[model samples]
Target: MLTILVTGATGNVGQEVIRLLLNQNCQVRAAVRNPDTATEILSVHPTAGFSDHSIDRVPFNFTNPATFATAFQGVDKLFLVRPPNLANVRKQIAPALEAAKRAGVKQVVFLSILGADRNPILPHSKIESYINRLGIPATFLRASFFMQNLNTTHKEEIKTRGELVLPAGHGRTSFIDVRDIAAVAVRTLMEDGHSHKAYTLTGGEALTYYEVADIFTAVLGKPIHYTNLSVWNFIKQMRDRGLPMDFITVMVGIYTTARLGLASHVTPDVEQLLARPPLTVRQYVEDYRQFWL
Candidate 1:
């Protein structure tokens, strides 16, 4: 069995990847900061029904270099993701990638964002460049906007404020479920022929926030709307809510990119990878309807 080391193992996408890997009967070593917390969380996860011996936990912190080698030891492949708050790529990620290369890991599946190579300002773009510089055999999964945001960052607004607010004015995004991205990542890690290739993972359709709100309303049996706020105002609101400046800036840049209609392109890569159509926004909303209610 190939041993895969998964970073950010407790995160949404990481958890989904772990679930799928376990279902495939692959040996998974989850690199998390807190094994006890991760064990508690995974024990209750809906997809976590396998034996404890199938999934193991190891300590790995991107900001801490001391934990890298131990986590990378005996790992054949790696599933890497940059934590959203860690912007200093050179300081945090570069060393870890270097360590992975040194630890004899053969292949890496990096969770990157769509258009990462084109957007120099984004940390993911820089990380991708660094990965290439190291000459590690890797595949990049440039995933689009995640539909799980409705339950995460935007859930409060959808439930309390009765609206979805962002700076993506009149622009559509090919929002994909993180689970779909996870599935593609699993394939890339386990299957051959994907080395050094970048896959743009997206949902089946491109929909504006307005259209998304319509789906939310229909699914929840209540009225919900999309509010387009100016970028500055959005930043101010996030700042007021105590979000860090770095995170706020990153989010503004993403929404600004969408506002320019750059993130609206729909791709068939997810379907191609999974051999089935990607999940639609309506299906996602219906699946998580209780969150909005």
Candidate 2:
């Protein structure tokens, strides 16, 4: 069995990727930060029908370099997720890449943002380029904005205020499902012909926030609205809400990028690779009903 280590295994994408890998009866490892996440995964793993796989649940913190070796031990494949914390996040990625290289891991799938490999304005794009130039065999899944983000965090605002507000004006984004992203990641980790390739995965439609709101209202049978605030106003709102400067900066940059139409367009890869059509916004709204409840 191929030994695979899934870092950030407790995350939205990580959990799904780990589940998909385990379903194949592969030797699966979950690298989590706490025993609670491990315990939760263990309880659900068998019920999810993955108890037969080699379940190596290990603790690995991005800030702690000493634990890297132990988690990398006997590992042949890797699925890397960026830690949620932005402080020293870049500093941590290179070392982890080095450790993966040292461990002789065959292929690494990075959950990178769309346009990260090409957008010169965003720092993540530079990091993605640097990783591409490295000696190791790596694949960057430059995924679009996850639809799940809106479900959890943005949904609160939408439900309370009846509006979806952002800085992008008349610009569209190919908001994708994290579930689809996980499926692609698992396929890349398990299959061949994916190395040296950067896949730009997206939902089937490119939609502006207004159009997105309309879609939600149509699907969910409720009134939803879109407020296109100026970038400064958006920053002020976030800052007034006590968001960190780093987060505010990145979010402003993302909106700026979107205003320039960076995130627009649909890709055929999702349907081609998965042998199914990517979920529609209607489906996303249905999924959000569960999230809201």
Candidate 3:
């Protein structure tokens, strides 16, 4: 069995990856900060039905170098997620990639953003460069905006105010589901012939926030509006929500990308890799309707 070490194991994508890997009967090592807590979370995961003994949870933290070797041990491949809070790629992520190299991790699937390769200003680009510099065999999954962000980040606003707030004015984004991203990641990790390549993953359709709000309305039977704020106002709103400056900065960059009409490209990589069409926003809203209700 191939042993795959999954960082960010408790995250949305990580949990789904674990679920799929377990179904494939692959040995999964989940690197988490708290094994016991991870055990609790994974135990109740609806799709991840593995018993506690099936997974090996190793304590790992990007900010703490001491935990890297133990997590990488005996792992043939790696699925890497860059925590949104860790903005400094050089300081927070480089050492762990170096340690993975030392531990002989043969392949890596890195979760990156859609424009990271072209936008050197983003931290994901810097991390990609470092992975190349380390000479680690890797596949970059440059995923587009996740549909789950509606429930995770903007849920409060939508549920409370019945509106989507962002600085993406009249810009369409080809939003994808995290589940699809996870599926693609698992395939790259398990199969051969997917090394040193970058795939831009996105949903099949590009839709503006106005269209997204219509989908929500159709699903939930409630009025949801897209409040297009100015960039400064959006920053103020995020600051008022008590988000850290680093996270706010990343969001600003992402929205700015959208506003410039750069994130609107739809791609067929997800369907090609998974042999199924990517999930649509209407489907996402219908499935997650309770979040807005």
Candidate 4:
């Protein structure tokens, strides 16, 4: 059986990837910072048909090079996820890819953001260049903005005030679901014909914040308003909520990308990969309605 190493196994997309891979006939090694707490971290995900013992937990950290070799050992393919905080690709991610190369990892499927290739300063683009430099056979899954951001980043605001607050003025985002991204990752990792290619993953349709608010209202059976704040006010709001400057800056950058209309491009890659249309915004809102209430 082929063995695969999954980085960021505790995250939303990682957990979904592992869950789907567990249903297949492959060996999965979850590379985590703390192997001891892997179970606790993964318990939040829905585990319908698999047990925790099925996944081998190995210690891995981007900042620490010592854990890289051990985690990459005997792995045929690797799913790489750059941690949100680690923007310095040279210092943090290079060592791990080097270790994976040294360990003879055959394939790599990296989770990257949309437009990473054009944006030179983005860490994902740098990492992509590094992988090519190292001569590793790889695939890049450049996914659009995740729909789950509503449930996670803006959930508090929606739940408490029934408002979607952001600086994305009149911008429509092709918001894809994390589950669809995971499915594509699994395909690239486990299947053939996907090497050395970059796929821009997006939902079936693009929706503006106003349309998103309408969907939320229809699903949750309550009026949800989209509070479009100015860029400066958005920063102030994040600061008032005691968020870190780095995180606030990242959020601002993402919203600015949307405001510029760069994030509105729809793609056919998701349907092409999954053999079906990607999940719609209304579907996501309906499935995750309890979170807003």
Off by over 4 Å in 3: 46-50
Model 3 CA RMSD to the hidden true structure, in angstroms:
1.2
CA RMSD of all predictions: 1.3, 2.8, 1.2, 1.2
lDDT of 2 by residue, 25-47 (tens): 57888888885657665556321
Alpha-carbon local distance difference test for all models: 0.89, 0.78, 0.91, 0.90
Error of 1 at 163 (Å): 1.3
Candidate 4 C-alpha lDDT tens digits along 1-293: 99999999998789989999998889999999998788777766743434868999999999999888789889999999998888888998898899999999999999999999999888889999999999999999999999988998999999999999999999889999998999999998888999999999999888889999999988898999999999999999999999888888888988888888989999999999899999999988888887889
lDDT of 2 at 55: 66
Model 1 spans with C-alpha error above 4 angstroms? 46-53
Q: Which of the numbered candidates is closest to the native, going by highest lDDT?
A: 3
For model 2, what is the C-alpha lDDT against the true structure?
Answer: 0.78
Rank all candidate structures by their TM-score, best first, as comma-separated numbers: 4, 3, 1, 2
Clashing pairs in 4: none
Q: List the candidate numbers ranked by lDDT, top first.
A: 3, 4, 1, 2
Error of 1 at 175 (Å): 0.6
lDDT of 1 at 86: 90
Deviating ranges (above 4 Å) for candidate 2: 41-55, 87-90, 120-123
The TM-score measured for candidate 1 stands at: 0.97
